[model samples]
Target: MVSFNKFLASVFLAVAYASSSIAAPRPAHSKFATHRARVVGRGLQVEAFHPPSTFQTFGEGIDHPLSKRTESTMEDSAVAFVGSQLKVDFNTIAVRSGFSGEAAKHVFLRQSHDSIPFANAVANVAFNHDDKVVAFGSSFVTPNSIASSSPAIPLEAAIATAEAALGGKFNQHPATLEYFVKQDGSVALTHVMQIQDGEAGIWFEAFVDAHSGELLSVTDFVAKASYQVLPIQKEMLTQGFEVLTDPQDMTASPAGWHNTGTTSATSTSTTAGNNAIAFKGTQSSVTTQSSNGLNFIFTQDPTQAPTVAANVDAARVNAFYLVNSIHDLTYKYGFTEAAFNFQQNNFGKGGAQNDRVTISVQSSAGIDNADFSTPPDGQSGAMRMFLWDFTSPMRDGALENDIVVHENTHGVTNRMTGGGTGRCLQTTEAGGMGEGWSDAMADWTEHNSSAVPDFVLGAYVENKASGIRTHPYSTNATVNPLRYSSIATLNEVHNIGEVWANMLHNVYAALVAAHGWSATARTDPTGPEGNIVFLHLFIDALALQPCNPTFVNARDAWIQADVNRYGGANKCILWNAFASRGLGVNAANFVDSSAVPAGC
Candidate 1:
């Protein structure tokens, strides 16, 4: 069988070079020209814009006695706020989703023209409890006239076109008519639908032109974790399993990992919990009696190659432990219900609940690979871990800590970046950063020192010292030669991700040097230590940055996060770290740059 890396490389290359025949949109006559805008990708699409808040009245009206702070009231207030800022009618703004958290009330809105929603034109607004706006990010476009408000082709034709493009029949969802904004600012009437091919492991949101039977665009939903297992700091078996009681964080998982309610009652007698549920293939769940208090101690035979029949229980328990552990660890770093994290219960926090991670150990879906599928906020994300045959005895990916952490991070980045829409990281650059973030997060969890060490992913499962990538993640220039310019020639997401991950490695080193180290950084969020600071910026920047951000955008968000949290104390350190890796102040369009900020 072909290796996972080779399979992905070929797929990405085909996608990069594929030709498109859709007509481009006309030049945008933006009405919000006076506002600050951030454009990304080759399309020069305005991914985010911040309009002046001089005319905002959300705070004034919210404080009045007549104004009730209900979900409808919040939606109306957000619509009025965005309408006034964007110079559009409030009727044209459709409320997509709204929820209230402890500190803020968030409302997601979509731009509409004549009651037809714009598929990609969206805005996210957050208001503090005092009714003052805290954050606003929008990709809404200026109003433009279209040739028609309805599709020329029938819904059947559109589905057929999508199936033809994917080369398979789809287990399709309901289709809706919407306005699609093209890269060049043109608009097309289209039928948009979510399509899934389970056997092929393909899930995509496809937009088919209604005027003409053409596929305008497709956003992939499957974020492949294509690397190798977790718990005990490193890959499993490398560090023998150790049992610890009550590992769940009270604030994150108040009901504990084994329960889904608000109390600490035992909910299951098997590897099922509030954060994750692990099972083998498509069979019944592996169960244990309550007599042992759910102790899942099983022996691994070192005499021969590993098989599913021999290590099923151990694999399920390890998978369950790793998922719950990562869930709690990340919650401390702000991947909570308010930020759209995975959990079966929200405990009255915000966001759509009833969505915990579903893990399949030793899955029969595929071989030599693992993947995670992220839908919207209320849907459960699925993680499939497969067995690898690279070594003498096959390796269970569920037994690898780095691999599990790597896959789980995909859910975190996807949900956080796009206001929990789970469609922002679809571009080549943005998707590459998703992979890079996964690798960087895995690397961070393994380190507890001031002196940074070289890290490699999937080393245990791949059975190679070099791991699965082209180069080891390192801060040294000679050790990892990848820089911003390296992406100019890189086609595969994993290869492109190396450059981004290495840049983060340098950032970690610089922060640790300036501050201090935290041995307990994984569970501790309070400190001036560099490790804690890195994680704070990492999670905060995901919410601050625009959807489909480039390297520069992500770097800017980190700097902004530091300024917001630390009062700009790490400005120079951050600039110097990014500058060393060719992502300096002057870096643009994947070009190498060495210049830092003028003050730095």
Candidate 2:
């Protein structure tokens, strides 16, 4: 009797456990919890983790195992490697786009559930010459169960909702259903569409919930291209201009600066071309054609203020030249068609086409400031240059090279980071870096030697020697004392950016000290100089970092970029520079630390 009762009790417990397992719902996927979570600006939580090792060597001189098996292409090998890393099937990983560069081949992949895509979840994989995985970064989320694949609301309704939210009209593209990963790590089905309002100076990629028809989020493509004007190395009008003929890099702009299509250059006389179109006040482009090709020179009165009417021709030409120059210069540093650069024709290269930059000189939009509107790939980016009133003779923003370059850098940094989505740098920390990068690029372009000097921005327009920022960028602590801790008290984006730019100034100085400087750094990319390495890492890290990266995440990406490109040759050099700025390995919680990484 005792043995029979014990057996009955055991059977009862087993049945109860089985019943509970069958009745309960499976837990929602929470891989994000396993990663480090930080609440950045705007109460937004981002999860990121740096693996102990970013690079893995399968065997000595051996190709990746996946590549060795069967006749596989580079894309095939990449998808297989990433799928294996994610513990998912390769078929589910979709290859969106990719580009092959001198150093490595980069592939952008997206995770798909059933047939729908994840709007924000993406992974960037790069392979070195040996077909080995050299670098990887991802924000991919695995879904346990999708509430519904079908949308309750129609596409038309979703478009209407997005248009209403943005106060703009749709760009005539079909809305697509995507699995959007919300900030809380929850997945929602959403209809994504693009809306543009040129009059309002706004362009956005808006996402609307599919089931409830609620507006989820919007990524503004229009970044304020604040400050305007164009120059060469000179940041202001005080530095005279040098006339450059056929300035376009043949390798970068194969069709030349004047041609937008495969056909040869045409001969009309406006500042319009494949890379940029310069006009003034609403669609009126200056039409002065010189025998030497689009050359219209004008004289400015040095003693008095200049009028926009008298200098519109020169301003338009300078603006045109500067925009095209930036396009070619950044292209050499890996901002190519495949990287979603601003180009009207891609010439069979990957990425959307028909999106050249539009330059509006003396634009009637506003005064004393400029702006650039960046839509996604295949849409034209617009730049509006305003007149500054700081001087007795108002200054044309279009004549300042630093201001123009600073604005163009907004486009480059926007497209390069987050896999060309143009939405990654929306958070306060990320947005601040955007501004910092613009300032740094401007500072870099003006430097022609290893003897780097403290740089000021908008000095000419502001008519102030101190420039617009609180302090000129300097490596010396006494000169510019901003550090990682400085961001604690900073609430505005530009102020936060001053701290970051100062840190980069230190990093730039350190790199120059370690290697050397290059005089032809602007046009030439094939050098062992510190400036070359700096630009390579600068562009490479943009793709390696996750969307909406913080200061630490960006710093880590730069270090990782060095590891992949230079075999960690500049590890200590980079860490020490960052450490000097209080962003060392031990730094945390916006606090300052002078410690370097253990190995360094």
Candidate 3:
């Protein structure tokens, strides 16, 4: 009854139906007949992502939402036609919320519809963005975003597991096992499945809770996936080049925390063993002579401080070099003018020298952790890391150079960018970042030595018997050594350390490849033909980062900002340029966790 052409037309009409938001198959562009045949296929719907609490964007400018480009207003079009240039406001709040320094966006659209369909048209029903979705949680089934992507659990296995176990329940995101050993039995993990729609895929993970044996969380990041190209230049968030000074005569005092041209009053270690340190200022020669390591040194001439100040300029320059080595991406605020002093005599009887660096070598003989943390009213600081003259064997892990470096970074970063969010676990994103930054600097300054910089902290343990060096960096939960912070919890600290060290090494290698040899900046901002290859750019990147910000955004911000100032595509090249030998990173792996999120 139907001709061949009529039958083909009917088939084409039947295949042109639109359906689904995120799971629809993509339309294949081809012959008119083939296009119609593929029109009825599915399309994709994208979902949102929930990352960790630790987030800090690079100091470079970030974006806000509600930009003119996203919203086509009379203002946006007039400028485009009049100026002959498409203008888009990059500072909108909506842009900030919608973007995280990424270069694109993703969406779904109708394939065969020639005209704008009515609000209630069949074609309009495809993008079910507001559709209410169910999520299986620990306690009970809860509501989730419209397009939920979770691994499905087989109902058959769920019944058996619940019957055999006690109270097992499901909580929220990351649907997996949540079991409780109580009077009531719980549920356990069964199995999960994938639910597809169009050209996209959504996989959910299901598990029972402990008490109620309910679904817990889902291990899914997206319900739909596609690419959206971002068209705009990034803005600088924090930009202020440093006032370069001689790395030898002056120090780069970031946030007035380190090498502040002033001596710290507290130098004694909290674990200074049974050693009774005597002060030369208060004790007579008879009493001092009898002591083992007592007469805490003091400047004979207090007012003539610059002499002592310039003496330890090595420490200051070392600090900068140290920090740069650790952070291939960072910023520098430059040196402070305050004078270094050690006149208070908090360590032994006398204080640390008013000008020189000193160490107590034992906690019992010096200031404790609590005292060290108590900063003066207006001053934001913790001399945990830089307050070191590391020598001999370390006691337990209490007073180690590495610990000092890690802790000092916290103080510097806190002062530079108001104190961190103070997240819980020291290994959380923020804490890990802080710890890693410090570890990198310290390891860099300590470079040239045979110390194979690693994630392990405080490897040089003190000989419990002789109170000398008995090297060891490992720490266990049950060690009970008052200073023993669990390595598991501290992995965030050390892993970040290795990552940074590795990054510095990589950048250094790249620098060698790019510049024939190590970068030696003869002057501040580079003297004459010497390019300004200072670590200030990188320091600024790290310093500009918002505490607790995500690593990817931070790294991307650094890259974009560098590219904006330098050339394009060659962004990675500048990363090495900003980090050089004078900055202290003699070599690097470029494996920055920021460069690679999965590594983080």
Best candidate per TM-score, number? 2
Q: Is candidate 1 or candidate 3 better by TM-score?
A: 1
* Estimated TM-score for each candidate: 0.82, 0.85, 0.34
Give residue 406's error in model 1 in angstroms. Answer: 0.8
Candidate 3 structure quality by residue, lDDT tens digits, 1-600 = 233344334333322322222144543211111010111112211111111222222222222221325555322222222222112221110110010111111111111111211000000000011111000001111112111122244444443342222122222222222221111111122233212111122222222322222322222211000001010010010121122222221222221222222344432221111111211111121111111222211212212321243212222222222222222112222211111111121233221222221121122323222112212112222222222123221121222334444544443443322111111112133343444455444443333322232333444332222212121211121221211111223323334334333444344334334443312332233322102221333343432333233333234434543433332333556443323211122211221111222211
Per-residue CA lDDT of model 1 for 1-600, tens digit only, reads 233344334434423332122234522212112111222111222222222111121221134221355554767777877887778888889987665643355677788888988777777665656665655667788644564886688888777766655544655556789887654456778888777765566676667678766566666667871001235476547766665666667777777777888555748666787788888755267535324565666655645555545477777777788888889888988888878989888887878888999898877778788888887787778788888988767888887878888898899999887678787776667778888999999888888457788998888787788888888898878989998888777655677678888999899999998898998877778889999999988987777665666787788778766765676789899999999999998987677789997889
RMSD of each: 7.9, 10.9, 23.1
Instruction: Rate residue 327 of model 1 by lDDT.
Output: 90
lDDT of each: 0.71, 0.73, 0.25
Task: Flag the better candidate by lDDT, 1 or 3.
Answer: 1
Which segments of candidate 1 are over 4 A away from where they belong? Answer: 1-90, 95-108, 124-137, 143-147, 151-157, 160-175, 225-232, 263-266, 287-291
User: How do the candidates rank by TM-score, highest first?
Assistant: 2, 1, 3
Worst 10 residues of 2 by lDDT: 27-36
Rank by lDDT (best first): 2, 1, 3
Q: After superposition, how far is residue 265 of candidate 3 from its true place, in Å?
A: 18
